[model samples]
Target: MQQKISDQLSTTAERPSGRQASSPRAVPVLTLVSHPQPQRIGERLLLETLANTGRTASLSRSAPEFSRPGLPPGQPLADPFLSRTPVQFAPGTRGRLRLLVPKDGTPVRVAEEPARGAREFLPEELIAGVPLVLAERVVLLLHLTRVPEAPVTQELGMVGQSESLRRVREDISRVADLDVPVLIRGETGTGKELVARAIHQQSPRREGPFISINLSAIPRELAASELFGVQRGAYTNAIQDRLGLFRAAQGGTLFLDEVGEAPPEVQVALLRVLETREVYPVGGNTPVPVDVRLLTATDANLEERIQRELFRAPLLHRLAGFEIRMPPLRERREDIGPLFLHFARQELEAIGEAHRLTVTDPRAEPWLPAALAVRLLRYAWPGNVRQLRNITRQLIIGSRGLPHLRIGDRLEQELTVDPQSAGSPHISGFEDTADPDELSPSRRRPADVGEQELLQALRASAWDLKATSERLSISRASVYLLIDKSSLLRTAGNLSPEEITRCFHECQGNLDKMVQRLEVSRRALQRRVRELGLGGP
Candidate 1:
């Protein structure tokens, strides 16, 4: 057995050394070839290769791209991969396999054959949940026979390179290999679902179904049936038996978006499934066996909901096995330019507007000016990426011939209406003030009044720290502290973990608020929350 395994390894040569040869060479019993219509043609050749050699084979194709749907008008549609697929020759394929996109006309070689009786293969990277096993196998084969010179493009569409985004990517990379539930916390237009997709793409279960169910979008009456399946005769509208998100994602991922909106009963049912790895269909007698990696996301605070008895504690715990917080776009000001440029380039390419031009003229992309970038960085992005992309497209189309000059004017108009700035109320020379309530007999100073007014402003703004800070001409951190030191802490809700989180959120995550609202010092509050496994798990 050992000799046979060794012989197989020698024939396969699984690992490639640096800089493979450009030309295809024939071995004693096998040969590799390059095909022009690689994506479509390579699969057939791979079968031929494996049939002739009784060994593993692979096929390769050139990088492909396709325009993404659901983009707003005038916005550039993202194209991740247009054309390219892989074929792996194995007796029976099972488990996860990596997919690679190769440069044009690369030769594909066979390294290993599939194990017999293998029923399915998990793709290493996901393109809409379709396995790239055969396509990737081909690319691997080609790389072994002859390495390509150019680097491959791994993604199709989207923009922004903020540090917050980089951190998100790093976290996804770290957690993708594990089966832990991931909780993505972010506002609308923050791309929570996109992050989930990225996680699925980089995970071992990439080839299986990546099913998405918006917990908030589904009607209350239908949610249970939709999420947990239903018997054919379970309800008045039931015509046939159905599989739920759990079954759909049996070997892959189930993305539960707007998870905070799940009704209390649904939360309990979800918790049961999370803890048991099983689900009982609505009105069904038997429990369905399931294997799923749960990925949940929400903009609302589950902790607050739990406090209000609107969410289940156990469900929240199960969903938050790991947590990722998405920072709003305004906070990552540096990404504005790159994001704009990316959007503009995509739009120009998609419309074939620049078909005759090799390089885009700087003047044509007026929103890319250095001065405009500075202004964009200053204005807090209320709607995040989606908003920015829309504004960019608007600028591009609205400014027509005088793109540069018009972009500047449009940018100025945007700055004027920026909710962050225009929303603030001026306080003269408040920087020179101190904690002077100590000297006054009433134990209050003009500063105290100012602080209270700020808190009221924040409350009126619906606890939006950015708008509050902009209106007060102060930093968000300072406003966070000021709200706690003011009167808001006295009226905090009950002492549940969720309530504690709500109070802290209302306080903009200020340490002072945790101390005052919870009637505990900063350290104690932190320790208690951690001990209870509250907030972030």
Candidate 2:
């Protein structure tokens, strides 16, 4: 057998502080999304600090070695199909990375596009995560891990390592023990209730029952009585005296979800409870003193509601004593793999299909393909964590008794389609073009999309040029034209050779600077420079 040839990216050097470093201070990391070898799933490789500008790092078949998180440094990824040649990474000016892939090396795809020659990735792109497919079998995500959020000792019952989640956890730790009304804010399905639960679990009221109520789900007439206690015959069907959510959660916590949806009467009643620390039961004059702590959550715009007078100003001030924002699933994408696995394990165990994740055959294809995983990572996740959890459940249950997890029409719809319902999936956006290599900018339907929808798709696709095309139902060339037309995006291809050459020297030949100034793709600009016969910095 050939010797165990170990290959890895060089250790990166420490970076300077502030935006000079990574603005928010982040380091690049490589996570194995999945491989045909199921054991490689979720393994991580932390690309270390590059000591200086000139020094660089690399990745080949054997690159992610013993230094791989949770693995011994001496042990390399023993995949037999990977190429010996490496894809290189070097620090660019201002916290960006210059990437190079050899033409002769194993085939590589960046964001599902062929990765040939050179490219550059901004720090923001790293944060959003850059997906790489190697040799068509291995998938790795290059993303940023902001400093200080590098894994803590306790799990805190949360399943992600993203920086946003770390901040949310920190808020919980700081405000949990304090006696205050905690308000959790975020979009729907972003897990506002989870944040509420975490606070309650960590607070002094942990021992007491945690009562939860959804104000939006309750009828307006019953809302007040439901929140406060209802005395016998308070209204029809009010059988006996009832203890309200506040009294039921005595010495514990009362979680008011969808608090923005609280009826006008309920809002007034709630503000009084916050002021008096007691409730006024319906059909009674006596005030019932309650020791419950309040934790309310909302996806609605409470301030807007206040502007419209649908919600009371006093109530808004009362609920937001301490605010904790639950990040949407798209914002905390790095946690998706862990969160998916957490959900998958639960569902698999529930149906006695835990073994489904691991196929014994060495030659079998991975049930969860890298393409699917990358799609999951790149998806807008409009439904947030709840959406992802539901998708995970669907992927597992819908594939029952199958060798691989089946992505049904419904599951695929949930996975690939956007919130605006971009409609059905086509065979390929690249199809129907006469030139094949290039589609005209003046093509039909490309100009029909307005600026806002175009911008929306661009953001939703994380500025991926190809992805934006798919989202807009247009060709790549048309997408570029639309981008060039918009003030938001420009292409180096649009700039003249002379203009690029002049800027190249003005920036002291720093491609990163040129990228910032030219407002063009760094890779595209780099290529243009080479085409112009201007050299690298």
How far is each candidate from the true structure, as Cα RMSD in Å? 22.4, 14.5
- For model 2, residues 1-537, the per-residue Cα lDDT tens digits are 211101111223445543233333356777777666654566676656442224567788776562334335643445567678888776653344666788888787776577777765544456556777877777777777654334466557777767788898989999999999999998788888888888989998899999888888998888877888899987788899999788889999999999988877888888999999989999878899999899999877788778888889888888889899888775666677778777888999999988866655545576677678877876666577888889888888988888766788766754652312211111121111224332345444554878788877766765555777777776654554455446444445446678888898899998777766775555556766876779875
TM-score of each: 0.51, 0.72
How big is the positional error of residue 259 in model 1, measured in Å on the Cα after superposition?
Answer: 0.3
Lowest lDDT sum, 10 consecutive residues, model 1, at 123-132
Q: Give the alpha carbon lDDT tens digit for every residue of 224-339 in model 1.
A: 98899999998887889999778888999999999998877788888989889989998898988899999999988778788888888888788989998776664444345456
Angstrom error of the Cα, residue 85, model 1: value is: 54
The Cα error of candidate 2 at residue 105, in Å, is 2.2
All candidates' lDDT scores? 0.51, 0.70
The reply for model 2, stretches above 4 Å from the true place, is 1-24, 51-54, 66-75, 93-95, 148-151, 358-364, 417-537
Give the total clashing residue pairs for model 2.
Answer: 10
Error of 2 at 63 (Å): 2.3
